[model samples]
Target: MTIKEKINKFISEKKITHAEIGRGLNTSQQNVSRILGESGKVSLDFVVWLACEYPEIDLEKLIRDSDHVSIVRESPATYQKPRLKEKALEEIGAVLDKYM
Candidate 1:
């Protein structure tokens, strides 16, 4: 199934309204309706936000149009902090320190 089809199926199965989705994403109900509507183009940023908000939905597999969409949660121990993010945080801290 296509991503839109999968998303539509998910919405139907979950009995979730567009307003609820909009609330979760901090967007308008109209915007959600547009996104879910036929011929509506789904953006990468929208997909990322949707995935982050609704962890239950396996968007990656849906994007690939995989038949089996499963949620695989990695352990915190298995998660590694990115050095770039660390450096950015350090830089922000330095800036704040300088200002304060």
Candidate 2:
């Protein structure tokens, strides 16, 4: 399944509403609705933010489409800090604080 489909499925399976996700992500309900809308294209940064916010969700599964093979990296982990826009940084930090 595509990332968008996965998000929709996750929402349904968890019985989560857009307002709830918006509260967690520190965004408006309308923004969350827009993000999950039929034509919405989830960005990598947004996926990362979602993972950080809802750690219970399998991020790898959410990110990987069914048609693609999952690659396992044997190399040591490297921390490349994400460069998010100001608004995104604020929202991510707020969401993280709530969970952490």
lDDT tens per residue, model 1, 1-100: 6767777777777777899888877899999889889978776556555555555444344555357533322322232334433433443355446555
TM-score of each: 0.59, 0.57
- Over 1-100, each residue of candidate 2 has an lDDT whose tens digit, in order, gives 6778777776777677888887877888898888889877776566766555444555444444445332222343233345334434554566556555
Best by TM-score: 1
* Runs of candidate 2 exceeding 4 Å displacement: 67-100
Total colliding residue pairs, candidate 1: 0
Clashing pairs in 1: none
Q: For model 1, what is the error of residue 5's alpha carbon versus the real structure, in angstroms, after optimal superposition?
A: 1.1
Backbone clash pairs for candidate 2 read: none
Instruction: Return the lDDT, model 2, position 81.
Output: 41
Measured with C-alpha atoms, the lDDT of residue 62 in candidate 2 is 46
Give one clash count per candidate, in the order shown: 0, 0
Quote the lDDT for 66 in model 1. Answer: 55
**Residue 98 of model 1, lDDT score:** 58
Query: How does each model score on lDDT?
Result: 0.60, 0.60
